[model samples]
Target: MRRLFILLLLVLSCSSKDTLPDITVKDIEGREVKLSDYKGKKTVIYVWSRTCAGHTEDLKKLSRLVNEYPDYRIISYAVAMDIKDVQQSYQQIGIKPNFITLIDPSVKFNDYFPITFLPSTYLFDSKGKLIASYAGLPEHL
Candidate 1:
């Protein structure tokens, strides 16, 4: 029985990291944005907070990657839950203006992203299927 239980736990954990909910989020401009809209393109969805000092480097690296790959779509979601804090972090970190910013107020991401940590990144293929998910800056960026 114990072995069976362990196997189930392992299976659940391994499989849960792949896909994410196609939840709707509000952009900084108050426009509704859906993850599904980015379908048919390589997309990177970054979830980070304003106060996470460790995320600064990852953000910078991601910004550079986005610039280098014009065909890829990168979206940033601020889990800070406050637009003011998000804006302040943006200015402090020097996030480029072209980056699309989304807000996840009410912390609904906990249901889909398993954000026990501060920063998480999800990568999707051209079909909008999740290719991989990482807790921090992945080595390949």
Candidate 2:
């Protein structure tokens, strides 16, 4: 019975890590935004830092995805960067993102979703369950 209980605990812990946590984060405008509010839509979160390479191209691709996939919610989460820097990067790229732009100066989201590397992309289903995650830009996007 003890072995079965341990196995069940392990399974539960592992499965819980795959879902988006009900945490609040800040948007570019410094407004409190709840991650849970994005539920009921196919969400794509792109995590990037200011120093990360290929961000410019990735942002451009994300812009295309925003237009191409209207059904999916594309979110650009900038970590360890100031709001001004994030805004500047967008302006420099010459593309206004039609999707959501969030700022994570302290990388609070990492606690829920482990981001081992920069420029990571995560896809979640309408139910807030993780569908797929890519270390770099996914070619399909």
Candidate 3:
């Protein structure tokens, strides 16, 4: 039974990873948005916190990517953060991000993503399958 259970766990783990879960996160306006909403559209799901300096840098790069890749449907999630508190700081720095950056205060997606090692970004194809996951900011188009 133990061997069978282990085997089952491995299979499930491998299987689940292939398809990104349909998780619900928030937008800058505090509205609930689900991952399924972006299905069939190439998505860039990023988990970030307002406090991380790395994340701050990443956001600058992300804005550039949005302008470069307007053809692709990019969704940059500002998870585990509140944009209101830092909006002035974000703007005072002259950083205007074009992509939709969501705010996830509920920590709902924490189970699937790591909060501490944030600024983690995920790329999904038009079909909503996770194609790439970058730990920091992405510089490439």
Q: Highest TM-score among the candidates is held by which one?
A: 2
Summarize candidate 3's per-residue lDDT along 74-114 as a digit string, tens digits. 66666556768446546766786677866666666666654
The C-alpha lDDT values of all candidates are: 0.75, 0.87, 0.68
For each candidate in turn, the TM-score is 0.75, 0.85, 0.73
Ten-residue stretch with the least lDDT total in model 1:
14-23
Q: Please write out the lDDT profile of model 2 over residues 11-124, one tens digit for every residue.
A: 988874677777777888879888878889999999999799888899888878988889899999999887898989998889888779988887878988889888899999
> Which consecutive 10 residues in model 2 have the weakest lDDT in total?
15-24
How large is the C-alpha RMSD of every model relative to the true structure? 6.2, 3.1, 4.3
On lDDT, the candidate that comes out on top is: 2
lDDT of 2: 0.87
Quote the lDDT for 100 in model 1. 73
lDDT of 1 by residue, 1-141 (tens): 999999999998876345555678788877887756777878887888866657788777777777876787877878857777777777788876466778888667677667766788888888777878888767674
Worst 10 residues of 3 by lDDT: 14-23
Whose lDDT is higher: candidate 1's or candidate 3's? 1
